[model samples]
Target: MDDVSWKTAVESRLDFLQRENLDLKAALKNILRENENIRSEFEAMKNILRKHVQDTDEKCNRNMKKSANKEIHTSVEDEFGIDPERDGQRVARIVPPSTSTISSIAFYSYLSKNSGPITAHHTLVYDVSHINRGNGYNKNDGIFIAPVSGVYVFHFSVCIGGSAYASFEILVNGEVIGAVNEESHTGMGYREGSNLVVTFANSGDHVFIRTQRSTIGYVFSNDMCKTSFSGWFLTN
Candidate 1:
């Protein structure tokens, strides 16, 4: 072969190889662009998912804090004389006697006065009154005072002769608040007493007990105050 033919063949082969290299470089660039786009899309999706998870966690934490705060408030209100069932309002309170013993001179008495505007005072006497047999003794003398504004439970009891029958009742503002009946004796009369409970109106109410049957024996000392009927209050 001559020098001119050899030179032409070499140039043609070089041109074909250069074109193949150029095509390979273009394909590689396109693949790299597609890979970069896929990576960017994955990063964006991950950021969105992270943001949603963080938001959900924040919402749950807020709800839990609110519930805990409400429970704490309710407990505090109840401890401070506030009725949780009554929208955090103060209710009535019943104060019982320090001692629950009957003295020789047993008597329970209270003055009739409104405790709404004026502060009322009450006193009880534990006295034993002697009564003649076959003659009826009426020693129904006592006073009840309201301390706070709310419903109250009044309890009363009494004993008479060998057979004990008592009339226990409750009063609100000097009015009958519950059923009053003679409690008949079943077993040992001297040992047992009549028990009763009644609901009284809030504030300014009075309660007392009277003997329904005549007593041949002296008014004996019993729990409440003494020989006569006794009454007290308790808040419901």
Candidate 2:
């Protein structure tokens, strides 16, 4: 082979190698740019999540403050007596106590064990009596007898197992006032139901909870979830 021909082939190979190196560099640059974009997007999402959590915390704090400030004490003048300046005549004005006193009556009871496959018109016996201030609640019979004639507020909560449905009725002197129903259709879990009722009762009126219709599964009562009943005298 001639020297000039060999030198021309060598130059042609060097030019091809240089072009390949430039192409590899361009591809690497593109990959680095894409990585930067992905990193920025991830950071932005993290910031959004952080802001949401912070807002939720702030909202909870504000609600707690409002609850704490709901009850406050007043002076003796605010408790009784009428303002003659407003009506030009004397009228009686009496303010109730802010907290529960010795005269007030309240009771709270819960089921210590689970009740199973309750039928229609079955009574729920809350065996564990936590607070029976006036001895109005009977743990054995699941009944609350009003100790004094007044307006009363009653609350009850019931939890049922998954894949079942149950309905309960709050009774005052054998009359239904309110009802609670819980239904779970899907997987194995727990569902809860609660109801509140306000009624006027005499001193001997009876209040209780009973099953409305057929119940599919058992009621749940455990450390995590409790079936409870409570009542308090509101006003006379």
Candidate 3:
């Protein structure tokens, strides 16, 4: 109502607004500082991840180079009867082969295929339901043919139901390399034996497993991790 009273009220209102403004500015500053801290932490994490990835890639490259170096041909001069220094030279660097050769093939069984209840004694061939890499194995004929000249590793598992006796021999090119047997069971749902052999093979050599000539039994091949046969070419 009075001029002096009006002026005093307006000044009081102005003082209150100035205090509120200062509070708002302080809040904004705190927000900006928090944002900067988060950004710095985020940048630090990104740098650490990048460094880990870089180290892993460098380690992989070093391992690959070391593996390649180990693949170089070593001469066996004593077996060939030529002087170690005379027949062929060993090279240090990795050289590309003149001819490309197929070197990898593997197969595994997944289901039941009967080996034999037919004759008193027979060679066992496995059934093929699943194959992993290559088809060097003939599931129909129960034989594996090498796809390249190399040392190969072969594994055969023989599982059988309640039976008198069972024995299997692993054969490479018609010669027995090794054998595995399961025998003398009074009560059995399933019994298994496995054999592994690492042997030299030329391209097109055949490999298989056969039951002993007098053992009258059958191999149980199934999806239940029973009888399965697998082989892979190791090196050429």
Candidate 4:
């Protein structure tokens, strides 16, 4: 071959290689652009998921806090017999013994006044008398001497105030038949507890209530809330 023919062939080959290199560069640029777009989309999705989780957590925490506070408030109301909407304290229910029978042996009495700071083993003398049909309960010594031999139902309630506690025992002839314990744990307001006793007694058996263990606060009594005791004959 001649020198001219050889140089022309070499030039043509060089041109072909340059075009291929350009094509390759274009393809690489396209691939880099696609990778950048994919990365941006991935970052956006991550941000959306993170925000959703944060919002959900916040909402759940708020709901849980609200429910917990409501439960606590309800518990306090029920325990203390407080009616928050009426803004009045609920009085304890005191149903007088049924007066159906003409010969019913029943009595009802209450403190009617605040008595307090009583020592342990002190007898609670219910100062006021509402009923003593059989003439058994003595307001002076707070003792009920049975007027007739029969089965009796006795109930007593004790109220304590001012962050203190008191324990009492309903005694029959100097024996503990039932017990009560009341405490005002919040250092304010009052707390009350009661118990009932059903037992047989002779005509002269003595029944009374007295402090036991300890007494730390004042006992409360009034028209709204009364520390009281009562007993009725159930049967012979």
Candidate 5:
């Protein structure tokens, strides 16, 4: 071979190799750019997911706190009989019966004024002539609200005067528990009627005497103090 031809062939081979190397370098640069873009996108997505999780946790915590506060407020109200809306200081309380033979009582001696047509299953108001041991009785509305769950004995007595008619019912809440009816037909002497009830009651239950029937009647407590209502806790 001639020297000039050999030199031309070697220079051509060198040019081809150099072009291939440049091409590889350009491809590597493009791959590196693509990797950088992917890293930026991955970081953004991770931040978004982390923010979502944080927000969800915070919302759940707030809801749980609200439920706990509401439960605590309700418990306080039930235990103390505290109506937050009312203005006056709470003087009245529900005294739980003690563990004893005669632990609780709701006995009132007599009514000074004759109060009736105490009809239609109405709660009676009585004068606080006497109360023994403990008091859960409201003299304003003659209802005994129980402070503890127990069995109790309740009694009511009345002497219907002349020209008078009377009937009594012992009630635990709205249910009729006991009854007694008497009428003075002669309009001359007093007629006596009484009702006794042994009942089971839960805390916050109401027990009271109501007049089912009354006609031109007077429940007298004058000299003998015949009209009376009494209750005592029998079992815990």
Candidate 6:
């Protein structure tokens, strides 16, 4: 072959090889870009799966806590048979001693170990006196109500004239439970204190003290009129 023809053939072959190399590089770049996109998609799927698992675990934990609380409440009710969620009943009250003349007295309600703790959610105070005497004996002066179901302790006291006999009856829901009666002393008159305990099934039960005579006098004090309860429910 002639040198010029051979040289021309060699140049044509070199040009063809360069074009093929350019095409191959472009194809490889596209493959790399596609691989990067696939990897990003896989990472996104992994993140979503992790979030789903965490949410599912949290939901299960919440359900378990709720079930446990329900079981505990049910067991307590079954054993005690007393449901504070329902009706309320009065459990205790302080009754002032009976007096013949008009006098001021006080009553106190206290918390006991058998009773539950006193909370804001439960508690109520009724008329201090069921029937207040304008200048004489008052019947409406010393009454208290239970705020919740529990055991309660009550204390009450009264003072009468030196020469007169002082007598007081403690009543729970209008029923007589205790009494304090004594002859008056020359200096102190008649001062008597009484303590009574009662268990209320629930809440809203009434407790009061009534004077049997008019000459008997009574006085009520803040220290004498207090109510406290417990947090634990009693069971058989």
The TM-score leader among the candidates is 2
Clashes of each: 10, 0, 0, 0, 0, 45
Q: Is candidate 4 or candidate 6 better by lDDT?
A: 4
Which pairs in model 3 have colliding backbones?
none
What are the per-residue Cα lDDT tens digits for candidate 4 across 99-123? 3442567889999788778888888
Better of 2 and 3 by TM-score: 2
Query: Which ten residues in a row are the worst by lDDT in model 1?
Result: 111-120
Models 1 onward score TM values of 0.38, 0.58, 0.55, 0.55, 0.53, 0.35
Worst 10 residues of 4 by lDDT: 93-102
* Candidate 2 local lDDT, residue 72: 22
Please, what is the whole-model Cα lDDT of each candidate in the order they appear? 0.47, 0.85, 0.71, 0.85, 0.74, 0.47
lDDT per residue for candidate 1 within 1-236, as digits (tens), equals 89999999999999999999999999999999999999999999999999999999999999999889778765656456455667867765343323332222122322222111111122122233343121121233354444433444444443333433333344455455543333334454454254555464454444444333333233334442233333334432
Question: What are the per-residue Cα lDDT tens digits for candidate 5 across 1-236?
Answer: 79999999999999998999899999999999999999999999999999999999999999999888778755665666564435534434455424453464556545666665565656667666577456677777777888777788888987777777877788887888888877776646777788788889998898877778554567666665467788888876
Please, what are the lDDT tens digits per residue for candidate 3 over residues 126-192?
Answer: 6653674556887777788887778888988767776646777888888989988876455767777
Evaluate model 4: give its lDDT.
Answer: 0.85
Stretches of model 5 off by over 4 angstroms after superposition: 1-106
When summed lDDT is taken over every stretch of 10 residues in candidate 6, the lowest stretch is 112-121
Q: What lDDT, from 0 to 1, does candidate 1 have? A: 0.47
TM-score of 1: 0.38
Residue pairs in clash, model 1: 105-126, 105-127, 106-125, 106-126, 106-127, 107-125, 107-126, 107-127, 110-143, 173-205
Can you write out model 2's per-residue Cα lDDT over 141-161, one digit (the tens) per residue?
999999888799999998987
User: What's model 2's TM-score?
Assistant: 0.58
* Local distance difference test, candidate 2: 0.85
Model 2 bad stretches (over 4 Å)? 1-92, 95-103
User: How does residue 113 of candidate 1 score in lDDT?
Assistant: 20
